[model samples]
Target: MSEVPSPRLRISDQDRESALTALGEHMSVGRIDIDEFGERSAQVTAAKTRGELSGIFADLPEPHPLLDAPKVAVSEPEKPAWADIPPMQRIMGALLPILFIASIALIITTGVTWWFILVPIGISAVGEGIWGKGWDNAHKKLGKQRRRELDG
Candidate 1:
């Protein structure tokens, strides 16, 4: 009632529907007759502005359109995919750059070219960190295949 900011504000289908529902409630309570309900319902349906709806409820009490506040749903904030990784895995993932740097330093100092071996290890560590236990299953499958090859 008093909440409507302006009389001239354009009404929506939802607003009209709310008014119609209120009118129906009024009719059911014997506040308004069927013919009067029909007439008021038509008026409500035809209402294009808040002003047009205001007069329809002028004679009625309590049950009015657009009086109750609409409800809003609140949701929890989403976490990033990396946030779900285990703490140990996250630590290993973080140390991957240091692994590469140390490998490169070893390669430069020793000139043995064995630093190439660290690349796969660093890649596997980071992959396990990001993909979690899924990487362990894949690693197991690879190991099984190698074992079958040796046994055969």
Candidate 2:
């Protein structure tokens, strides 16, 4: 970015685009005024030679991208365990409420008391989910430990 490129050298599309991008960054950060940015941007787009492109940015400092990277991409972040809304929880959450309402209506109409069976089933389902999660965590930990043992 130090040496102004050869003035008379033919420019490539990439060179023009790079200059245009640099101009945009400079304008966005208030290094140059909007009018200057617009004028230079037009000149950059129409520039046919490396010198014409270089002249547009001759007075400006290097753009931000040239100074430092904006961001480094790491691996995609994982969703937390709690954020993983399981399908069974979703289905049963809705079904439980509906079942409770139906149980109330059925008891009021028939006094049969048989629809109450779903209450125990719902409680057991919750316990199963809690236990299942514990088992999964324990299983993963054991797997890691086993791998380490084998590697050692």
Candidate 3:
């Protein structure tokens, strides 16, 4: 079995700051995107604190390319609409149990059979799951449609 390399020494604050400064210089010279610079800077900073950043800097390219180019800003990725639905459905689905319990409490308070509440709750849960699944499938279909449109 091949032995894994032991972890390297933790990065110091000075090392992290220096790396960030270098990365900023790279970004300023258009060697790297703003998003890339920000991401790498954060990664280096976090890794320094957590002792994980050392391996990253070991194989350094001497005199990096960012020393000469003009700076450019990075464009953000567009957000998809379906990102909103899953969470909303999940929250509403979760609430179903609490609502069912409350309904049962109300029925008991009125001296009615608690069993009746089970039918509605069960039906609602099944319906919710089916609806959520259908919505997800629809989103997938839309994504496929968009991809086909783009490809064509």
Candidate 4:
């Protein structure tokens, strides 16, 4: 069985500060007037034990610091799966569209099947990203540095 805590337990400065803050909240909400706040603030300042501080909030409702629940911590939202990939892959992916546009433009202007050349090059570049290793360790390190520079 757990032992019951003594009312005579010494209160720390932090405990006194919390009680004072609670009293300030009570005063701010007009629950306690300025005169009563002064009295309560004095009591909080002179408090030496847990029992002494407890009486300061006896007549008040919620917002009692000692009795209040701890605040919950908020976690960061999840990042997309593709956020971790190196820049080379994204660049290669982007290259395909540009190549396609250029091929179309060339075909329209000169009308000589420019796509035959650009299409294979674009496919090979993008295919290397999908199937072949995009970069070695050194290149990956450089990509990370570049990402940091851009972000920072």
lDDT of each candidate versus the true structure: 0.75, 0.64, 0.59, 0.72
Candidate that beats the other on TM-score, 2 or 3, i.e. the better one: 2
TM-score winner, 1 or 3: 1
Name the runs in model 3 displaced over 4 angstroms. 1-7, 49-60, 63-152
Q: Residues 1-152, candidate 2, lDDT per residue (tens digit)?
A: 57754668776666666677888888888999899988987887788876676667778888622322234467986544434545555444446546667777877888867757577466547746765543323334445566876797
Backbone clashes for every candidate come to: 0, 0, 1, 0
Order of the predicted models by TM-score, top scorer first: 4, 1, 2, 3
lDDT per residue for candidate 4 within 1-152, as digits (tens), equals: 97755778887777777888988999999999999999989998998887888888889998875623354568997554346656766555556556767777777888876545667476766567665754223335546677976797
Predicted structure with the largest TM-score when compared to the true one: 4
Model 1 per-residue lDDT tens digits across residues 1-152: 55647888888777888899889999999999999999999999888888899989999996899733473468886554445556665555566656777777878888867857568586866687777646534434445566876797
TM-score versus the correct structure, for each prediction = 0.45, 0.38, 0.31, 0.46
Residue 76 lDDT (model 1): 88
Indicate the TM-score of model 2.
Answer: 0.38
Per-prediction CA RMSD (Å): 15.2, 11.7, 17.7, 8.1
Q: Which has the greatest lDDT?
A: 1
Which candidate do you rate higher for lDDT, 1 or 3? 1
Off by over 4 Å in 2: 1-5, 64-152
Clashing pairs in 2: none
